[model samples]
Target chain A: MDMYTCDSMPSSRSEGSARSKLLSLAGMSKSYSPTVCALNGLDLSIEPGEFITVVGPSGCGKSTLFNIVAGLEEPDAGSEIRFLNKPVNKASELLGQVSFMPQRDLLLPWRTVIDNAILAIELEGKRRADARRIALDMLPEFGLAGFENQYPNQLSGGMRQRVALMRTFLFGRDLMLLDEPFGALDALTRTMMQRWLLDVWQKHRRTIMFITHDVEEALFLGDRVLVMTARPGRIKLELPVTLDRPREPDIVTSPEFIRLKRELLIAIEEESRKSFAPTPSAGH
Target chain B: MNVARDLLKHLCEALLRGALTVLTMAVVWELVVRVGGVPSYYLPSLVDVLAAVTVAPGAYVDSALRTIAETVLGFAGGAVFGVLIGVAFFQWKALRDYLFPMFVISQTIPVIAFGAVVVLWFGNTLWAKAVIAFYMTFFPVTVNTLQGLNAVDPRQVALLRSFGANAWQLLTRLRLPAALPQIFVALKLGATLSLLGAIAGEWFGDSVGVGVLLLHAMYNEQIPALWAAIFLAGAIGTLLYAVMSYIETRFVFWRDEL
Candidate 1:
């Protein structure tokens, strides 16, 4: 983990030691009630602009982790989080600092394309006219220029997701947490979205933590992939991609890509068994 | 230009349909009384009813306007109060748990039973009738508003919360807007209810409104006059309901409903 950080961070800020990254969390734990422990002792860190992928089994608390980071869910005490080198005591302190896209598009049905694109900025109490101007400038890149007047229902699933992405992007370009962004898309659309996402990510070099169930997607997109444990979720493995950036589509068939995919699949399969097995585990 | 043209076209179509409906009703009513040899005392002919209205057109018009004004006043007050209460209920679970059941209990005590008491308290004033309408109009709006607010997608709320939206912001921007289709549904129902309330209140001794006219016709054994009062009352309720539906259509244009 120590070596992985140095290797990926080419633009590492050297204001001396302590390795001040974009975000870092240690000893994170969350439990809904006395019986339901969702996450336990999860430690993770993100570099300035590295795209990281997270994969886990069905009940493994990926969403919980994202919620904690997004400031929607407060983790149990004993967790420590630091963002932009400042210690965040409350989960809400991280809000507006990290951009998040949930499993669904969640576009407001009533809002037009341009209006939807600026939802986050509007929420932040910015002047709507200025947000509109900013969103208009960025609309074409998201392939939503002509659909400015159109509502969310009028757009295709892919376009709606892009619009949501634009909303997230327009809010802040520092850190983005995407949970299965293309999970609902068909195979072809998902593949297309991945490529499009890569193109957009390149254009705007924002650090992203993308969660996906697809091993291939995790391999195709990440600078590193983190496989989480089942139930009381924690980082089980963090494998660096070691693949070249601006990666070609044909590289999925490459030996290196296949090798990485196998490694991630093995880690995920082990955890999936524990969650699915009809047996009494130590914790209920 | 196109939107206005479309609105005009919609209005003309609606009017045509309404006219066709009234014509069919009138024809059926006239045929039943005349062709079936129904006595005039039992069921007045449509022509007799129309002639009754023509004879005291000024009185009927004045009475109808008074009832409508009362209904409108009550409806607006009830709708506004209902929404505010709904929001309050949503904000505080404890308050909702305590007061909501009382509201439900209050509803069970028939509005008509205590309607006389309302008249006793406020006495024969428009305010009394409007208060009754307000009572009738509020409960459904409150229930529907609370339901609508609760029905907002939790994920959407989470998304907004992630954007640093405070509770008030969440209510105003996400919950309220998302709850609108449901709220409008209640408003349409409330429109009819308020009218019913206004008329019912007038029954507890008032001399100006259609309710007073209805009582007069019933006692005098003037069957045509009674039919005329019924038609005017029906017209008032239909007018109020039409206004609500129009506002709902214009505002909640995105909702996929007829």
Candidate 2:
């Protein structure tokens, strides 16, 4: 465990310590009633501006981990989490600091693209005009510049997700927690979205905790990939990717990329096989 | 669907419906008066009713306006109160647990059975009619609004939580907006019941409004007048329903695609 003075931490993170001590989960466990243990004693940390992807088999508490960090679920036992150096006692305290993009793009069906983008800022008490201006500036980056007047249903799945991402980005938060954001996209669209996301992330440079089951996705986008075991999830391993930035989609065929993908596949396959075993372990 | 074609087809169908309904009602009235051998004093021809409506237009119109005023007031007040109650229940589980069943039980008592009680408590004024209408309209609004609030997506809640939205923000931004469709359902139901409530109150006690006029006409065996009053009541109800539908379309238009 590392403890740094709040003043020494990056000032960009308004919570406690800066220096990318960004988000850490230590000895954290969550149980939904008695029968289900969603996460068990999971320990992990993300640095500032780091793109960390959590890859796990389905039902491995990847989304659960996001929920715990977002304050949607209370952990059964753990040391309190600090954003900067300040204790994160409740879900609301982390609101403006982290923008969460859910698996399903939950754009308000009634609101236009621009309005949906402005929602978080409006919730934060920014003037409608200002929030809208900020949201407008984000449209071209997401390739949704002309669709401002359009409704969510009018957009394709990939476009909708881009709008969703734009909404999160326009909220102007430093940390973004994405829960299988591109999981619903088709393969080609998913690739396009991954490229777009990397471009957006490069420019915004906010710390991100992305949850996905795709090992390749984790390797492609994350600075470090955290592989979680099946149910009663725990951080099985964290592999750092020293791959250079501005990488193209074709980089997935690179030697280093192939090696990392095979390693992630083996680790995930081991977990998948364990998930089906007769007496899988409950707590790590 | 082609937008203009759909609209034109819908309008033509509606007009056809109007003609068919008028023809059916005329046949039923004529049959009751002729075949059932009911005297002209009790049940008159549709023509007679139209004549009565034309002769005493001011009287019927005045009563209708009064009844409509009561219905509108009651619906608005009930909707406001119901929304507040829904929001309160959404926030406090303990309160919801204790109050929700009570609210349900209140609905179980037929409004007619409570009519006299309402008059006794509130007296025979327009305020009393409005109170009765409000009671009739409020429960649907509360129940539907609560369901709307409860139906908020867990993921959306989580997303807002990540943004560090406070309880108020979560409720206003996520829960309330999610509740709009449900709230609209309640509003539509409330609009219909508001008319019932106003008339029910007047039936128990009150010398003004359509309900009272209907009673007087029934007493004098003025069948045409009675039928005219009935027509006005139906028209008013339809008008209120149409207005509600328009408002619903205006606000929750997103649901039209679904």
Model 1 CA deviation exceeding 4 Å by range: A1-18, A280-284, B1-11
Candidate 2 per-residue lDDT, tens place, A52-102, comes to 999988888888777767666677644357676466776445546777788
Best by TM-score: 1
Clashing pairs in 1: none
Worst 10 residues of 1 chain B by lDDT: B249-258
Which has the greatest DockQ? Answer: 1
Docking class of 2: medium
TM-score of 2: 0.86
Off by over 4 Å in 2: A1-20, A33-36, A80-82, A85-93, A281-284, B1-20, B23-43, B97-108, B113-123, B256-258
Give the Å error, residue B124, model 1. 3.1
